[model samples]
Target: MYCKHCRQVMDNDFCPDCRKATRMPEADDICFLAERGHPWSDILCDVLKQEGIPFLRQSNLGHGLMSMIGQGLELESIYVNWKDWERAVDVAAGLFSEDVEILWDEEDELQE
Candidate 1:
């Protein structure tokens, strides 16, 4: 399977590169895209729409708190049916160079 977030080709379901669990969206889930921050996320969404891939953007209540505390964590995400994961990933990958993509891990503990 492919890691939709970082576009890594993983042997198992999990993406070792991104250190995040990967799963196909259930029939009822709308989360096709991973949690992406603003600006870039906005561009991605536009591209997805332009490509005619159906998806949804989801936000959590913590976003409000993050804004209030100025944490600036990106909770916004794009979602699509699991069935479209491949095409959706392809469309997203074509927009940028895979050689330079950076993967941000929120769950990583600070070494410092």
Candidate 2:
């Protein structure tokens, strides 16, 4: 989500400007589905939403007392409701396919 004050992309639910949670709808459930990077995670979430599947994004923290005391490793991940898992995956795959096709068309033009 974009910050209201600075208009920059927010790192988490809380907007840096107002120090309040962004007024976006929360997902019904959460499941760690995919983890490529920030960009891919964002894209996947968007695809799921476009397909009417609800989801939430999350990340692992390291170099902290909580990390050392609780979890041993840090791993970024994305999540969707169990009910929406299959449909979300399908939608993400379709989005990827469309992106690939667009890239192919651009490449074909470059080749010509």
Candidate 3:
């Protein structure tokens, strides 16, 4: 498939190069959950899975570079469907301590 916004070939609804959704966001559309480096991202992914939440991890360094560097020097952006955002955020908060604030939205006053 091709991204309607960037006109680039895409394998899914999200445009990796553009770092945005290719189509209009539906109730189940993917949304950014968090951005973390290395071990944290890996840990978060594992926790999300244990809680039965579906997630996608996108590497800032791209697949080829991530394969080469193993995501050690870059951040990974985690995404979950809009329908799962609340649950995913709860899972994230439970995984981290109070001092480790996980901000889902700027206007959302709710921090964990």
Candidate 4:
């Protein structure tokens, strides 16, 4: 177990040295759900927030010129706590699916 903020080994929920909260170590029983580059990822995240579920979002986006050229990198991964994984999965499936329909399309390319 380690504290993400302090990079120190953790024995409890709070780091002893830094006294900061540390996420529970991942165990065999721990579960997670991930969404990759899906436009609906934002909506799903909002739903999870509304439902009071803890989650982590890992988005991979390019910076500067590369990003502007490619509309940024395309990985937006959402991970949820094991207990909430099922709920998140249901929301992703029942409400939103892999093939999410484009709600609206607007071009916002920088013009300079």
Assess every candidate by TM-score. Answer: 0.51, 0.45, 0.58, 0.50
- lDDT tens digits, residue span 1-112, model 2: 4343432333577876678665433344344456645456656665566567766665666457545665434345666665676676677667666646323234434754
Q: Candidate 1: which stretches are off by over 4 Å?
A: 1-31, 60-63, 98-112
* lDDT digits (tens) for residues 1-112 of candidate 3: 4444553434577887877777654556677778889778987997787678899988889788878877578898898876787798887777665566454445434543
Write down the TM-score for model 4. 0.50
**Top model number, lDDT:** 3
User: After TM-score superposition, what is the CA distance of residue 4 in candidate 3 from its true location, in Å?
Assistant: 12
Residue 21 of candidate 4: its Cα lDDT? Answer: 85
User: Which scores greater on lDDT, model 2 or model 4?
Assistant: 4
RMSD of each predicted structure: 12.6, 12.9, 10.3, 10.2
- Candidate 4, residues 50-76, lDDT tens digits: the string is 678777876666456446766434666
The candidate with the higher TM-score, 2 or 3, is: 3
Error of 4 at 109 (Å): 27
The Cα error of candidate 4 at residue 25, in Å, is 9.7
Q: What's the lDDT for residue 24 in model 2? A: 34
- Per-candidate Cα lDDT values, in order, are 0.63, 0.56, 0.73, 0.61
Could you tell me how far off, in angstroms, the CA of residue 98 lies in candidate 1 after the best superposition?
6.6
How well does model 4 score by local distance difference test?
0.61
Summing lDDT over every window of 10 consecutive residues in candidate 3, give the lowest-scoring window: 103-112
- Candidate 4 clashes: the total is 0
